[model samples]
Target chain A: MDYGTTPLHGLPSRVTICEVGPRDGLQNEQAVLPVEVKAEFVARLVDAGHTLIETTSFVPAKWIPQLADAEELLDAITLAPGVRYPVLVPNERGLERALAAGVRDIAVFGSVTETFARRNLNRTVDESLAMFTPVVARAREAGLGVRGYLSMCFGDPWEGEVPVERVVEVATRMMALGCTQLSLGDTIGVATPGRVVAVLDALAAAGIPVDAIAVHFHDTYGQALANTFTALGHGVTTIDASAGGLGGCPYAGSATGNLATEDLLWHLHGLGIETGIDLQKMVDTSIWLAAKLGRPSPSRAVTALGDPLPR
Target chain B: MDYGTTPLHGLPSRVTICEVGPRDGLQNEQAVLPVEVKAEFVARLVDAGHTLIETTSFVPAKWIPQLADAEELLDAITLAPGVRYPVLVPNERGLERALAAGVRDIAVFGSVTETFARRNLNRTVDESLAMFTPVVARAREAGLGVRGYLSMCFGDPWEGEVPVERVVEVATRMMALGCTQLSLGDTIGVATPGRVVAVLDALAAAGIPVDAIAVHFHDTYGQALANTFTALGHGVTTIDASAGGLGGCPYAGSATGNLATEDLLWHLHGLGIETGIDLQKMVDTSIWLAAKLGRPSPSRAVTALGDPLPR
Candidate 1:
């Protein structure tokens, strides 16, 4: 078998990875990384073969001070030609900043649960969607690719359990609006395999193509990988993962961030799944970031594979 | 709905927890946990509602230096009435020591993979089983309950994949030898949901009672909980988990330990399964143990809970 970028099956010769470390990851860290370090980290990720890199979120500085350098970071970082770096844009203003910073791809997010929408983004579910409509329209007119995030699609902290129909309705609206792909976010990380199956079942029954669906899960409760397997078993391929489990939800107190890329890739490779990302490189990057943050990694794979500390 | 210890589906209103931190947990840690700390830790676990605990192994001290104080720890720890403390016995000699220590239960382990068995215990698969036959017979005659472990039942380090038939054969032989329950170990943590389903199906087809089976999984590749879900869906009730995701095979270089008890309980509770362990208490104990080890807890759930660090 070829060591680098080998095909899993005859179906495809490669896998596309959407690295969310710079955006989802850095935003969740308690220690705000310096702009130079953030630029270096993003450059390292690009060097490590991450194609679809989520650069930064264009949220207000007061909302998430960690990524307040979104504009500067995007401008300072060296961009490679084939790499597609997408920034999170909440409104036309955020989109304008991203476009000004030379961003060719932008992502807009809304919530499925009204309670979470109000608490997280300070808007109602409908209001959140409406806020993104103009952003999506303006981005599409600028020849930019648009991706919509449906937060708390599986469950919400305040609402406990979300109805599948509500998630589907929001997802359908996003897809119908100029968004090319819909990523379902299990924001609070309370999902199980059965619940994942239930959500996918409802969505498929609603005449949604599995190809348009991407699953995002946090490893807060360690169900991310299982849920990912369930999603993959449903033939929904796209997955969003942080490089080192670097992100955590501030609202969902004590919630870990997105699934670790190293851990997720380890399982994918073991199961003969073709994910183009390198596992060892991802582990090394996690080690570096964990040291920078003065902590052990949130990723189990990185801990297990990295060098053992002297007793 | 009550969150307290109430009966679910009329199956025992309470659960019997067996903490493997002493034998299964500490043996896999790089640094040796002091005998006093180990004893105190076991005492704390017992105080926190664990009635049955696997205290330590009877293996030679030279083999695993980290657990060299097994006898001392077992001797110094206070045992509660009706609390069954079991120790692993590799052979007749190991059994003699455990029996002398007043242990009421003895566990004998055999691996499904010949390669893992040889690398792990310095004996081939058949040789190891042959070595355990007399130990099991002796434990039975000595009026001690016997539990058998089939390691690498899911996957192995040297051998990439293990067949279900191989696991069934080992399980059947162990059952015929008077082992009360067979704990299938996912040694390298490569078992996925589909593979777990297939293994359970094969075991059932061979007439193995689901109730008599316990699943032990490592989160090496993040599939332990997923595998546990598959086992539970098939009616297997008993689960084996470590306190803080401690322990890994000495043979498998970077394999993670068993799934964290807190994470497993969270999923089981979400599924409405009756595993009478308190989630909060488990998290507290894990944090306490991590403090003793002077490192972050391997469990994401423990860290995510964001409880104050143990003094």
Candidate 2:
């Protein structure tokens, strides 16, 4: 009854959320929780009704020690029958380590911006895509779901504005490599709603359906929810979020949190879109996670639902 | 040049920002800065290209100790010709004080929820409206700008959902009382974009032009920016924001902060709407204010631009 008298329009009937807190979220955090604790966090998220939970990354321990216990964490947590636990794989070696651990879902990341690809992934755009080709081929042969993450699709701190045509080019190639899904990331949070609309349109023109696209926005400039609104208007239904709006870009020193899962859910549920995710349970998990990190959740919904000061 | 290749549609070319930090923002803060510092804060806001600033409140000292020096602050600050400083006056007594101080603009507060009016204002809605009638009349007689603020226009903590019809009725009365503008406040931050669109339409149907309306939203649920985008689509160009998201409600203890001025500027400028507000100068004022309060600004733009940690 509290849904208000207004009829909603131009949004999806349901949404699929991919929780990236365990991998992308924690990897940026300075404090590393124990592997057992990480497993517990994953189990709690699954309990919160998230079907696609990104549990860990297969990168070397030296690169992201926070998620270094990927194998241990994967073995320790319970994976529900309907749930998907995708781990980030940088290359064939990372993919091998993940396959050896019985991971059936994995994602490769590259930047649409050339500078980000070189500085972060140590390759040019062509080189990074080339490196991912064999990895995706192998994953498809193994009957696993492959996803591609395109970072800095909108703007980059160093490379400046990236053209939408360039993003479409990279995304189409990733799809051609047998990727089932591609997430467009506004890594620096400089995206506006109009730019999101343009990029989505351009990608559509490049033969990628809106359903194949997921939006990933950082909340550094507080444009994530608005940008998400724009994406929904374009019929893009999948979104990537971190619990507690976790994750800071180490590359961009001033970037803060991601678009929080709780914040995103609050708006989605309010719009009468079924995400199949429990709001209270997600809030509990975020509160628990923030406690482990010795900070309050930087999420408006979490704060609105409870006290914000850290215990 | 970075406004993107897609031209915006259904949005205004120019927007008027009503800076609410000094009044609505600082009123909730516990640490009271000296009157001199408050005066300097107003002057800095004027320098930041804000044409309208809610500088202080005329509420009694016992009620709001933080702004007890409203008179001294008004006298101390230099008033720029192009800028307007509006003071919040609760009733006849507050209005008399403001008039004696040579104030040119004042705002009276009411609520769409009767419970908020009865409990907080200690009067029923009818009694409060009756109380504001003479105040607005005298202010108009003195040729001063009179604005009306209606809180809990969306929903209330105790009253649940507020009907859009009720908001329209109360707002129409206020406008008839000679108030130039009526700002609808989502005091609890529960409104979605659809609800905002409906409410704005209802107000318009009631003969209140969208131009005579301003929107005020709490970022309690991270919906402020998204709701703002909806307002912009409806041609409601005036918005209320707190610098550094400085305000919190003592009644709604879980409520976090107001929508930050810097955060709003980031997207509005990105959307190519001219607000005349200087982003860097607003950041500087927020930084200075946060330092004086000995806390970090809870603003994403502040964090994205630089660290807001205590000095």
TM-score against native, each model: 0.84, 0.96
Please give, for residues A46-97, the per-residue lDDT of candidate 2 as tens digits. Answer: 8889999888999898988888888899889877899999999999999999
Give the Å error, residue B214, model 2.
0.4
For candidate 1, write residues A134-234 as lDDT tens digits: 88988889899998888887777666767778988998888778897788898878777667777788888987888778888998778888778667767
Q: Individual DockQ of the candidates? A: 0.28, 0.49
Cα-lDDT of candidate 1: 0.78
Q: Chain A of candidate 2 scores what in TM-score?
A: 0.96
State the RMSD for candidate 1.
4.8
What tens-digit string does per-residue lDDT give for candidate 2 at B1-311?
A: 14243336777888999999999999999889999889889888888999999999999999899999998998898889988889999988999999988889999988887888987798988899999999999999999998899988888777677888889889998899999999999887888887898899899888899889999988988999999988998989899999999996766555667899999998888778889999889999999999999899989888777564321
Clash pairs (backbone) in predicted model 2: none
What's the TM-score of chain B for every model shown? 0.91, 0.96
